[model samples]
Target: MSSTAHEAPPWLRPRAAYVHIPFCAHKCGYCDFASLAGADHLADRYLDALERETAAKLGEPHEVDTIFIGGGTPTRLEAPALERLARMVAHWLPLAEGGEWTVEANPGTLDAAKADVLAAAGVNRVSLGAQSFQPRLLAALERNHAPEEVGRAVAIVRDRFPRWSLDLIFGVPGSNIDDWKADLDATLALDPSHLSCYGLVYEKGTALWKQLQRGEVEPVVEDVEREMYELVMDRLEQAGLHLYEISNYARPGHESRHNLVYWANDAYWGLGLGAAEYVEGTRTVNTRDMQAYLKRIEAGESATGPNERLGPEERARETAMLMLRRTILGIDRADFRLRTGYDLDTLLGPVIVRFVGEGLLEDDGRRVRLTHEGRFLADRVLCEVV
Candidate 1:
């Protein structure tokens, strides 16, 4: 796409873009994302509204190095709709050469035709939601796919996309250490370039959360969960995947460039229903209601819900907190100073010293990073930083 000649609005142009597709075949019991099952009937209207929303929010066509299409399940869209969405992006946004374009897929939804369409539309990366490989755990999670479907989907994806990522969840109600290892082994057998392993957390309003409260399901023991975490790190590292973030591991050069924009606190434009954007120094979120989003777009009104402008010190604190989530940690002192216009030590000296003393942080000669223990309690550490 041709770049727009006009200067980008301070809150519009971003280095990365995240587009949310809020439809799924069925919502998992634990999911809280703004998504619904059987919403494909509104797919056409959603696409139209999405384009309008994009036009309103992204006033100038800037070259973006990373584009991440995530959501309930982007692959749930019909092939033609998927192609249309991809083309809409290419037509409206300038993409850098060899840019990272990724789409999130569910094993139950992806097929050969869909994979081909995505590849043809310049989608070079696929992140499959293969939460667990065990049939029992799959049932527990209410995932639609059979255990074998993950392998088949991976094979199809790897045949089409150069880079593929698999998302796995550990710490299920009945998940034992052996089962976790088996899941990891099954995933690695497919030879994916990236893996995102996450510990299960029960949100307050989810069905799983209710079940947890009612004693219908048991949470994994804290020490056992910690052991599972270590297992992932050890096994994935042996498989040659480096731990990039607390929950992400990647082979060299296969890291998710789009998500790094978030972890680095860099500017990004998020479009579509329930999407959030951080551009320049302001953050905005679109309405979660599909009807409201469409109505606003049809009326030629901004679909944004609320906007917040971040001041200099606030931005610096956010940057530090976000960067700390990465294994590489915050950049060297000079880079941090340049980005925030303040000395890193001056702003966070006491917190850093305290965490370092507690063995939760490490200050290498060039950069600071979270220790393994620190990653497990990342929320606490990040709260202290921000």
Candidate 2:
């Protein structure tokens, strides 16, 4: 499963690409992405390295179905720099006709000019980082935007782009039911095609984690968080948004096609610092160090990190776990058999029966899916299945 000198492209052509832009105006208190603040000076070098990595991984003129430019905060780039990066993608790995091109933007950074540039450059989708609408909650999270800025950003995006989404965070320590409901109401008022809601997590080495150690903030109780989650689901569904993934809801046709590639366990190429890719049965990631990534590109070197090659059995297990995340794409018994050369019924017979009996799973002859309660504990269920 090693990459040969010839760069062994797998039998299946990659339908997706994820480009990382690791620059932010300021990092959030709970952030751990490979992003930095006060690093705009490295923009030129990083773009050069990104283009090189793009060329090396995808080669020239390949047509991919979807392209996602995620961040630190992609909107932090100036209009000209953003245009350059977009044009490079168009020139190198041209997207398919009607392909989805999504860029992650922060509300504070996404100006109308930059939004227009992205639209003109064939970016059809924009995902805004409007984590919260409450100013006090945002201050606690160390986010910079005011509540008004989110509406303005959404207006600009809706006016300029063909499709757009908003990313929201809930379950913050100081946030109450009223605050959470208010955020949801504000978000729905904007009428975004897609919405992603995430529960706040305290990762080690993050500022939020440090605050917890210093007794500055407390973790939200699990029961309260679960209640908030239920409220979110009920509200969003009432507004006609379908819950596509655990944390994602979208209008019927507005689901993120690029993200679905990952959830479906398909191959993709990831370019830029700290980007990860899964191809040819191996998962590969680029170096997280920005300077090292740039230097290697300058020296015409590949900036790949450690690689993991999965055997057939391992790949099947991985695929099952990922596919189960999508509510619509239930696990097909026969397709699973063909892909893994293992019978799902035989391999997970006891586990499936137990879950089904407990009302955690539903088996409909040819496939299986998570029940409502099962969706909440999907992580634990996935662990059991895998």
Candidate 3:
């Protein structure tokens, strides 16, 4: 939609916030986030700077609908430090009643004290980074936690929180369909309300990427990866965790509200190093450098690195691309025009017609969504639309 003269457009109400915690015990082989290992000493300083940055940006109290504290393992902070961070969230975040407050944590590192701190801070959901249950696959993925730790964390979260999610990885170097099945089964056994299954991506500059280049580690073939993804869909559905987003499965009412804000192309606020925000047709990201981010926030300077103001066409295209990722909540043509003042068919008529004719999309006049075949070839179809 067009940006009005209002400083914060009413059309883009701020309902979501993402807080980044970039401290970790170690970096994984396949990781490239703005995380620093052996940086526990920086937590106190980072938190102090983060509070300043948050206060500077918030301007006034915002009744946030969802708050996600993601990380390089937020639990890596010591108990008192974690409590301090949680207190910051509780103090400034102003989470709405029964709002979703989620914390992303590593399995083994989340001790009882940390869990207690998060629970006390009103964090109602915990997303555990339990990539896989197999020890061999875990070692190959450079995960330090044992399989048993996942179960322990799940038990603790179950007792402390009302909802939780598990993140599982498939298409590992040596993993097969059966191994994936085993992992899915193990995850279901933990009784999580949500599950996010992702294929292993060998990003450039990661240790895994280098290993692939050096022929030290082989990635799962594309065909195998597709099969594993299909398996995840089938197994999660059978286990009652229905597919919501492409890579996320949730029991009814357990969907990740914060992430859906991005998929729905809505506004959000992000704080701390490397965090991204989209508010009122504009997008910006904080500096990825830890020291720079801290210094900038502490010095009362802008920490945002890249900034862009998206025009109407740009917003519509982005919204279409993102909303199309939803398995069930397809794009509504009438609502689309109301939101963006653009005819959906005019914007993507040719692309949609081409894919729909090819049995990739189902456009029933009112709404448009991917067919099963389209979902299988999502990348190709999305390329056509975007």
Candidate 4:
């Protein structure tokens, strides 16, 4: 899609790109991302640095097939700054016709002005981080948004964007089955086109992890969490949202294209602090240090923090891990061989046969997917094979 003669060959062009917005009103207990609260004063400088980073990509206008602007609360940017950021990105990373352009927003942060700016700038989708509709659970998760704010954000989004998603967290400490079902009830009331329900995870170094260490909270039983997940699948399907991936459900044709890029093991560009990019068979992660990222941009140096190029054997294993996450459409054997250059039978056939016999994996000669029993034990099964 490049217009210049010096551009990389078509094969090297990225089909997807991601932009990071790293400011928030306050940090959530479970967040470990490069976000700074009480740093609204740095917004102007951060935007300037982000533009510089985008410019360094220097190329004739080219179209990316998908663009996802994620955050530390992308909606935290003021209306004008948000508008400018949207325009700057559109100018530098033009979208292909029908490309999926999405921005992630927190419940209370999104306003009508921000929604208008996003819609006018061609952001056709919004993913609202509405952790829970239950006030007690929201507090437990340290999410700073009223339950009412979600419906308000949903109103703003639905009027402008036809495709929007809600993020809900289940398995919060002390939450019972009724509470989990209530969260689902509230979400379905909005009639969202897409939905993601994730179980609470206490990532190391996060406040939640420290709380666990201090015995301030107890972990939910694994059996209960699994039951919550099964409920999510059943209720969402009954509500007409199909389970396309383990954590994601969507109405027809409304699946997240950008996230699908990662699950499909395809290439994408990541711009901004703490972002990651996978392109041309190499994976690169930018520094999570905001100052380091800004300084590299100011000096016109590569902000590419660290990267790895996987060997053929490693790539095959990685592909298996990612593809199995897709509950419905699992690995395509022909595509696997074509993409990884590893024969399915020669490399993983034995494990596939064993799992199939164990009722963990189902292989239909062309595609291999997890059986219902296998989905619950996905992590263990994938580890054994990978």
Off by over 4 Å in 2: 1-12
- The true-versus-predicted C-alpha distance at residue 234 of model 3, in Å, is 1.0
* lDDT of each residue in 1-386, candidate 4, tens digit only: 44334245322457788999999999999888878788789888889988887777645455788999998999999999999999998888888888999999998999999999999999999999998999998899889999999999999999999799999888888798899989999999999989988889899999999999999988889999999999998999998999898789999899998888888777788889898987777888888888888888889887886689888798888887888888888998897787777887798888889999999999888899998889888888789768
Tens-digit per-residue lDDT, 14-119, candidate 2: 7678899999998899998999999999898889888887777665566777999998998899999999999998777677778999999998999989998999
The segments of candidate 4 whose C-alpha lies over 4 angstroms from its true place after superposition are 1-12
**Model 3 Cα RMSD, Å?**
3.0
Candidate 3: where are CA atoms >4 Å away?
Answer: 1-11
Clashing pairs in 1: none
Candidate 3 lDDT over 1-386, as tens digits, reads 22212355334867779999998888899998878899888898999998898888886557777999998888998989989998888777778777999999999899888999899989999999999999999999998899999999888888899999999989899999999989988988887889988888899999999999999997898898889888888888888998888789999999999888888888899898999988877899999998888888888998998689988898898889888999888798987787778899999999999888999999988999999778779888777667
Flag clash pairs in model 3: none
TM-score for model 3? 0.96
Quote each prediction's TM-score: 0.96, 0.95, 0.96, 0.96
Worst 10 residues of 4 by lDDT: 3-12
**Candidate 2 TM-score, C-alpha based:** 0.95
All predictions: root-mean-square deviation over Cα? 1.9, 3.2, 3.0, 1.9
Clashing pairs in 2: none
Query: What is candidate 2's local distance difference test score?
Result: 0.86
